[model samples]
Target: MGRIGNIINRKGKQDAKRASVFTKHARAITVAAKEGGADPEYNAALKTTIDKAKADNMPNDNIKRAIDKGAGAGGGEDYFSNTYEGYGPGGVAVIVETLTDNKNRTAGNIRYYFDKNGGNLGTTGCVGFMFDRKGQILIAAENVSEEQLMDDALEAGADDIITEEDGFEVVTAPEDFNAVRDALVEKGYEFVSADIKLIPQTTTVLDNEGQVKAMEKLIDLLEDDDDVQNVYHNWEITE
Candidate 1:
């Protein structure tokens, strides 16, 4: 499995953190709806965001309210999507995605987290070039046969499919993501996790224990912040 897959799996098991997870998803949904339209049928981005939120078991009511809030059916704060690039411990490339009404507060918090953990935030695109944006869909191995999935996924326009011990990872180009995912869904396939993600081209490994601890802390702090939606890093975490 990819590093992002591992992170998703770990987060999925953290039932205690469900509230925070939902908050992030909700924020993303609102942003997608506001940028595009609230109607998922007319808005591809909103549709994809809704699918992901549902996969995470976000409440239907919460999803509706988020859409309504974004559509201006109800009054809500205007949220701006921001991306921050940085180097974590051991020169690991990191990208942080956030949705916030207050950019200054979010920027300060992100910079502080990086500095406190032996990392330094950098200008936009500083570490972004180290990654590629793609759509990644993970499905449990027990849910489908490898042969069947391979045929279906390829026919649906996926770029590649990787079989992992616990699941299958279906990859698609950014432009083809919505079509491929929707096609698979129409065929009755369910995903364990599905979303557009930044896949790192090369990874960095921290040999020093202190660096590893700092990196882990940095990630935890970023994820815990309500403003942060996603954090991508080229840190090769091993068991």
Candidate 2:
């Protein structure tokens, strides 16, 4: 499996809890809409969130309601974006992105999770330099030709393309993501997953079983949080 495939498999496990997954997606959408305007055309963040929600198969009604809530058409609690960087067992870099109305509660919970799982939350930018922000779009390899995909993706301003056993990962510069995705869509390509992500520059492997277990638990705990939208890590997990 490729990096995108690995992500898909991990998400597949998380998707088993359908309600929780939808709730997280909804929260992200609302936060994006709240920070930017409700109109996606004028709000790149909102557009990206909406696209991610759609890719996850979130219902249109739920998406609309979340947008309305954030846009103030339906008054709701305000949420703020918070990013927490940390190191897990084996010194693996981890970045948690969240949207929460209560910073104290979220921060406390996040810190507790890390502390309890053999990790420690670090100051901002501590582990940030270890990763690069990029746009990733995943397309299944079932019937698609790798050469054609590379040709189209490169033409659409994509930065690179990775061929995996199960799919194709089209990478793009953050600024060119929206245009590249849109161009692909116009050309009738469908996505398995598409989002701006923090891609790790290097990966850490835990040879000790205890540290591996701790790292896995740490990721699970972070991902299960209602306020946490994303948990990026540099741990090289094997199947």
Candidate 3:
């Protein structure tokens, strides 16, 4: 009975985390739709964002509402689009992806976080070259053969496929993200997450104690900032 209770509690916590992540992702989709166009057909980026939202279990109503807001018909304000570059502890380059309506406010808030957290915000090109824009997809590895998965991804134009500890990671070029994802879905693959993110070209290895503290502080700051849509770094997190 004790073990069963613990299992239930763990599942509940996992569900909550998933829900929160989906909410954040939904905000990103809304912002992307507003920046580009409501029609996914005409806007490839919007389509890619929407596909990710769907994969995340974002409700259809929520998706429609976000699109309406993006179209400026649902009383949703416009969001600004910007990228922030910075360096964390141990000179780890960080890229913060943001969608904000007010650049000054966002910048001030971001700067404050960095200042307080022992990092410094940098100019536009300071750390961007250290990362590459890549389309990443996460799918459950359950009941799926590695060979089969690789074959499908290769046929669908994936750049690389790897089996991570938690699941399978599918990588694609920025342009082919949507088509490759759709191909996998048509073939009945269960996706965990799919989106374009700044992938670090090389990783910075951190020592034992510094890793946890830096990661905790970074996550707290990033999650609190409404302007920060996604945060990426090349800090190699190890057990």
Which candidate leads in lDDT? 2
lDDT of 2: 0.89
Worst 10 residues of 3 by lDDT: 1-10
lDDT of 2 by residue, 1-239 (tens): 56657776877987787788889888888878878889999999998888888877899999999999988898888888899999998789999999888999999999999999889999999999999999989998877989999999999999999887788989999999999999999988988878889999999989999999899899888888888999999988765
Tens-place lDDT per residue, model 1, 111-229, is 99999999999999899999999999888776599999999999999999998777788999999999888888998887877888999999888899999999989998998999998
- Badly placed stretches (over 4 Å) of model 2 are none
lDDT of 1 at 72: 85
Error of 3 at 14 (Å): 8.9
Q: Give a tens-digit lDDT track for model 3, residues 174-195.
A: 8888889889989998766677
**Shift of residue 97 alpha carbon in model 3, Å:** 0.9
* TM-score result, candidate 3: 0.84
Candidate 1: regions farther than 4 A off: 1-5
Name the candidate that leads on TM-score: 2
Q: Is candidate 1 or candidate 3 better by TM-score?
A: 1
TM-score of 1: 0.93
Task: Please report how far candidate 1 places residue 89 from its true position, in Å.
Answer: 0.6
Instruction: Show model 3 residue runs off by greater than 4 Å.
Output: 1-27
Go through the candidates in order and give each one's C-alpha lDDT.
0.88, 0.89, 0.76
> Which pairs clash inside model 2?
none
